[model samples]
Target chain A: SQTIHQWPATLVQPVGSPLSLECTVEGTSNPNLYWYRQAAGRGLQLLFYSVGIGQISSEVPQNLSASRPQDRQFILSSKKLLLSDSGFYLCAWSPRQGVTDTQYFGPGTRLTVL
Target chain B: AQSVAQPEDQVNVAEGNPLTVKCTYSVSGNPYLFWYVQYPNRGLQFLLKYITGDNLVKGSYGFEAEFNKSQTSFHLKKPSALVSDSALYFCAVRDGRGTNAGKSTFGDGTTLTVKP
Candidate 1:
């Protein structure tokens, strides 16, 4: 079975500080990875998605960026964080590009930017 | 563009009673609908999805969803509610044309509370 792991289950960062969140998937190779943010436990806003290594497509334009350094390793980073960047960050992985594929999500990271 | 709507902001039901969480979607091509559940301070869990074939698709945790093409809706339903079912539910949709690999637009989410 495939499992997704995210680091720093909870994080507290000061404003303007750097941010880094890592997501790694085990038992799967060349999986599609995605980054999503949920605000106030409501709607989900897609941040970025990667189909392969070094390829990323961003949905929302903000201070956030994502990278796929390896086949199953994805990272979300920011040079400087904003107060609005505080939210629950979720990492998801799907088998392939087909829409029929169901996405599997990680435990998620809670970032509190003060 | 693809979008989904979960009309109800909240739903309340008693244990052992049937429950329904409504969902509707819009897309240029065929719609691929999905249901997910979220517990407090946790990540969303995949409940079920509607790709093709049966209009009534059964999913995890004894939940099912009916795909009504005419109505453009895929509402999640459960015959009996459990207190453990109380959580946040989300509906998502995307154009099944293979254009945007796994991109889906999610609904605002509905809070379901099942009382014993």
Candidate 2:
């Protein structure tokens, strides 16, 4: 059984501060990883996705960036956080190749930029 | 490119009644659709998916979705609604392209409220 872990379940940061969120998957190798953000009472917005190490595709241009340093380790970072950057960050993984590739998500992290 | 549309923002239904959350998608090739559920302050959970085969796909917690190619819709349905079923539901779609594309487009999401 594969599982995803995201750290800093909750964080409160002042505006203009740096941000770092980590995500890792166990029991699976070289899986596809993704980063998503959701505002309160709104839908999810895809930020970035990685198919392999050192490969990252950003969807919407924002104050955030994602990097897959290891096969199963993905990190989301920002030099300075904006007030709008505050939201729930989610990390998800899916099989590399399959007909129906469904994503499995982690517990997620809540970030509040005050 | 693919896109999904969840027409309703919120659905209100009484417990024990049949519930339906509408979803429609647009894709160039064959569409691989999925349904996910999320609780407050939690991540999205995979409920079910429709790749190929039966139009109706059953998923966790007795939730099901029917895929209609003609209508370009994949609506999530449940026989009987439960108060516990109150949460947010999302519809997603993937375009048929690379072996492991890894990018999925999602809809705005629908909020399901099952009242007792």
Candidate 3:
């Protein structure tokens, strides 16, 4: 069975500080990775998705960016964080071949920018 | 582009009563619909999906959804509601014939609250 892991289950950051969140999937190779953010009382917003290494697609242009450094490793980073950047960050993976495959989500990271 | 609409922002149901969370979708070609449940401050969990063949799809925790092509709806249903079923629910859609078939568009989400 495949498992997805996310680091820093919770984080508190000051404004203008740098941000980094990591996600990795074990037992799967060349999977499609995605980054999503959910604000309080709001729906999820897709931030980035990568079909392969070094290939990232931005669903929304914002202060945050994503990178797939390795086949199973994806990282979300920001040079300077904003108050609006505070939210629950989620990482998801889906099979590359299945068109209707469901996405598996990680435990998620809660970031609070003060 | 594919889009999903969850008309109700919140639904209230009593325990042991039948429950329904409505969802509708739009797409150019065939539509692949999905239902997910999210607990407080937790990630979304897949409940069920409608790919093809079956109009009614069963999923985890006694949840089910009926896919209606004519109505363009995939409404989540349960025979008997439980207080534990209170959570956030989301509907998603994917374009089956589009180039970005892997991409799914989600609705704003509906909050389901089952009273004890």
lDDT score for residue A84 of model 1:
100
The digit string of per-residue lDDT tens for model 3 on B15-86 reads 999999999999999899999999987888999999999799999999999999999999999999999999
Candidate 1, after superposition: displacement of residue A10 in Å?
0.3
Which digits, one per residue and each the tens of the lDDT, describe model 1 over residues A1-114? 899999889999999999999999999888999999999999999999999999999998999999998999999999999999999999999988577888888999999999
DockQ, all candidates in order: 0.82, 0.71, 0.82
User: By the DockQ metric, which is better: model 2 or model 3?
Assistant: 3
CAPRI quality of model 2: medium
Q: If the candidates were sorted by their lDDT against the true structure, best first, what order would they fall in? A: 1, 3, 2
Per-residue lDDT of candidate 2, residues A1-114 (tens digit): 899999999999999999999999999988989999999857888899888999998888888988898999999999999999999999999998764689999999999999
The CAPRI classification for model 1 reads as high
True contacts kept of each: 0.80, 0.65, 0.75
Model 3 iRMS (Å) reads 0.9
True-vs-predicted CA distance for residue A81, candidate 1, Å: 0.6
Residue B72 displacement in candidate 3 (angstroms): 0.4
Q: Distance from true position, residue B40, model 3, in Å? A: 0.9
Worst 10 residues of 1 chain A by lDDT: A96-105
List where candidate 2 sits over 4 angstroms from the true fold: B98-100
- Candidate 1 lDDT over B4-101, as tens digits, reads 99999999999999999999999988888999999998889999999889999999999999999999999999999999999999999978765654
